[model samples]
Target: MEPNRTRLIGEYIVGPRIGSGSFAVVWRARHRQLGIEVAVKEIDKKLLSPKVSDNLLKEISILSTISHPNIIRFFEAIETREKIYLVLEYCDGGDLAAYIHKHGKVSEAVARHFMRQLGISIFTFWLFIFDQISSAGLQVLQEKHLIHRDLKPQNLLVSTNEVTPVLKIGDFGFARSLTPQDLADTLCGSPLYMAPEIIQNHKYDAKADLWSVGAILFQLVTGKPPFDGSNQLQLFQNILTSTELRFPPGAIEELHPDCVDLCRCLLRQNPVERITFKEFFNHRFLGELR
Candidate 1:
């Protein structure tokens, strides 16, 4: 049976469904007494395969421990025999993908603002993940370990509670914890934002996320992905073989040269050659913003 709209899921009063995925449904809900709004993701265990259910629990575990202003806030989670509900901070302003769609690419000034926050958030997230490892006196194999396997515009949300919308990275469903010695072989995430190594089924590390950042930044300034094809097969082939990215005739003229240069560095096909997060953080493009 379908859950009632006005039914209370723990302390939250469920409202209309806000979003849905293959494994879960998100509802716009409000705290009964506090009156604060939230997004409650309801996952029907009966509908989920055991593997998917395990991953969902893992996502909850990751989110519950993370606390960052630029990352989505996780309030709490409740579970029943048949379903699990995650109460998350409501970002009424929606996601970066929809924002880009409406604006047809943002101005460099706006892109600069968003990119700075994105860089900080990405760097900080790794810091939080590594803090525990470092505290245990374990050797830190790499500058980065945790990978947000599905970094893209859609996973980035903007909070409407502020005077200007504040961007926050959301959706931890595809996030993974790895070390330099460990590499991910899972072929996940959107094809357009995927790194060449991921498309080739190569063992990828945190650098793969940096490649996604480049694709997102390129789309932010150009209003389109770097590569386009009629199907996934062609898209993967193009990504594997394409060495350079070309902007539309006038697109390059409108962006700062440093911005274009950063994109190029991040999108390098060779993961070993791609700029590290430290280098990217100190890049001229982001430095100019300061």
Candidate 2:
């Protein structure tokens, strides 16, 4: 319906779907003016109700506020009755999950290279490392008071050159801004990555990102998700009560002990026990970059 604005949105014609999720589809596009390449995130309005629409706009608002080299740049929002288009910086490499799926477990060299690049970007953005990557990222966000309720592997984008998989954390449909007095109760994010407190339907905050990031770290090294069940209830129960912090044998031998420790601290069942970005920044696992 917004075909009129296609000239404003991009020069590159809309090709077949490059990627998609429950809420939107991403297409490779070219800037009509600059004749430059870009990605257009087309969000279907029909898929969302009024409440959902508000949340989607909130995500757009958050994306609009943030500017980081490692984070994908969200240019503008173009809306029509049928669709909502978000013009974003294109990443030819696709997502990290797709890369991992095609390559199996990543080589130690590749993982470290990716981590170090992210470490620098993360340092530059928030200049802190919380219990986990997203958590550390959240510290900067919390300071600004933004909480990303959904954090997962699929949410992270990569570059084709692999110079750095610009960790463009996407899908903020469940995100919210918080205040000192705010106490969140909604349970969101992938069940396998949800924290125990969240699964209990208890009050929590951005600290919940730590749990999801921890799960992501484990999956990064092991190539297997930590939890899976036949049903949603079963998955929630496992996420809520499971006690094991298992990692593949000999996995840590290649990675620094500090990395393992960091993962453990991030994955801690007790949110209180979860490491803070301040402490995590001082961690040796992150390398002595500082």
Candidate 3:
């Protein structure tokens, strides 16, 4: 599809297309008067169902409230008769998924740095087991009971700095709010990162986010996901029944032992057995890093 180059969105001048998804198209834009670069997400209301539109709106609303150094910043929202434009901070370094692809098996020290930062930014870190990942500015969202259902490397944006890039959690398209007692039934998120409870179609809460975090941490250290299969059916089967996680050979000896322990606790099959946020924060794995 040919993109329109002559169009101006609000006070911003659209540049090249940076990203495209089923619900929206993101463009690199420069503020007309301020001369600052920002990302503009354009969503066509006509193409989305009412439910989908509501989700998108919720994402914008959630972003509006969250302001963390490790979370994407929302500038403004512009609406038209048939479309919605969301202005957000642009991360020139792209996402963690791309970074991992380019540089396999990040050093343990680097991973610890990123994980510690993410751990601190989390708000309302405990709820029967739900712990949202990243950003001191994200507390308001947790107080409101919102959860980022899809927590993966692709959704984690990286700042431009190569030496020590700051990872900002972005893309709240699948984010949703649920009360402490409520369990989310929707089986959403990437197949590779799906928590065991999710694959079983069992009711899940924000605790599911922790499982995803574990998967991401594992992949960052090992250069691959904990589980693998030839097809979706097999993958689902493995996730549902595989209770034990097998790390790469010599991984424990090669990396910090505490790091391995944290992954095991986070990846526990039983939701009740998973590490609580309080325990996680105080654990030697992260505490020692300080």
Candidate 4:
């Protein structure tokens, strides 16, 4: 029996199914009284493993506490014995992955615009966590950073606006509140956008997210990911062995030097050499936007 199909979850009437994944289905819904539209992600509890269940709770915990313009807004959660319905703000423009596929890359100006939003979203999360740790006098606990392990275009949703579409970071399934110093060793995230340390089974931290950002920025201006292979093995090999981050021949001439420089800095194979979030937020490519 599909729980939300042609039925109500609390006061919200679930309408058509809007999206889905292996364990969950997202429905377009509206409030009975206010008639306000929202997205309800219905997850089947029975389908979850212990690890996945823990991640779901972690995601809920993180979303419930954080509020930022660039992050997805969580409205409420309605849970039953069989399912969990997450009511969230509706974004009509869809995710950045679909946008990139449809538009087939964008101008450097457009890339900068999108990157600025992404930078702010990630940086704001850092500040938010920092403030909490400081307020609690837990500065010595270096494991308080919230790392969005999987930072890719697909997880970034665009909220349509009359002047400019707003990009909001979503999908906190792989996010963890641990700093780089903690050196989390979990192997997770998409192959193309994943940092090298993660792929090699090396301990990594929040800097891995910055590498994903660089990959996204690269794909944004070049129309394709920086590295590609027929299979995961080959892909990982290419990412590990590639000494230089090269731009498509004609692509470099069209972009600002700062843009290319930022990509190079962020994609450095060695995490120690990669630019930190502070530097990324202050990078010249995004400086003017700030």
Ranked by TM-score from best down, the candidates are 3, 4, 1, 2
TM-score of candidate 1 to 2 decimals = 0.88
Task: Report the Cα lDDT for candidate 4.
Answer: 0.82
Mind giving the per-residue lDDT tens digits that candidate 3 earns over 216-281?
889988888988899999988887788588898988788788899999998998989998665665
Estimate TM-scores for all models: 0.88, 0.84, 0.89, 0.89
Query: What local lDDT does model 4 show for residue 89?
Result: 83
- In candidate 3, list every pair of residues with a backbone clash: 121-135, 121-136
**lDDT score of residue 264 within candidate 2:** 87
The CA lDDT of each predicted structure is 0.80, 0.70, 0.81, 0.82
Residue 91, model 3: lDDT of 91
lDDT of 1 by residue, 197-256 (tens): 888888998889889889988998899998888999999888888878778779888889
Instruction: Spell out the clash pairs found in candidate 2.
Output: 10-32, 11-30, 11-31, 11-32, 12-30, 129-277, 130-136, 130-277
Residue-by-residue lDDT tens digits, candidate 4, 204-271: 97888889999999999899999999999999999999999988889889888999999999999999
**Residue 220 CA displacement from its true place in model 3, Å:** 0.6
lDDT of 2 by residue, 1-290 (tens): 46444444434566557888777888888765577777898989889889778988898888888766556778888888788998888878888778778767765456554554333324343443453333224455656777777777777777674634545566677889887578798867778788888888889976787677667766776676667778989887766676867677777676667667777887888888887655655556556553
- The reply for model 2, stretches above 4 Å from the true place, is 1-12, 107-139, 161-164, 252-255
Which structure among the candidates has the greatest lDDT? 4
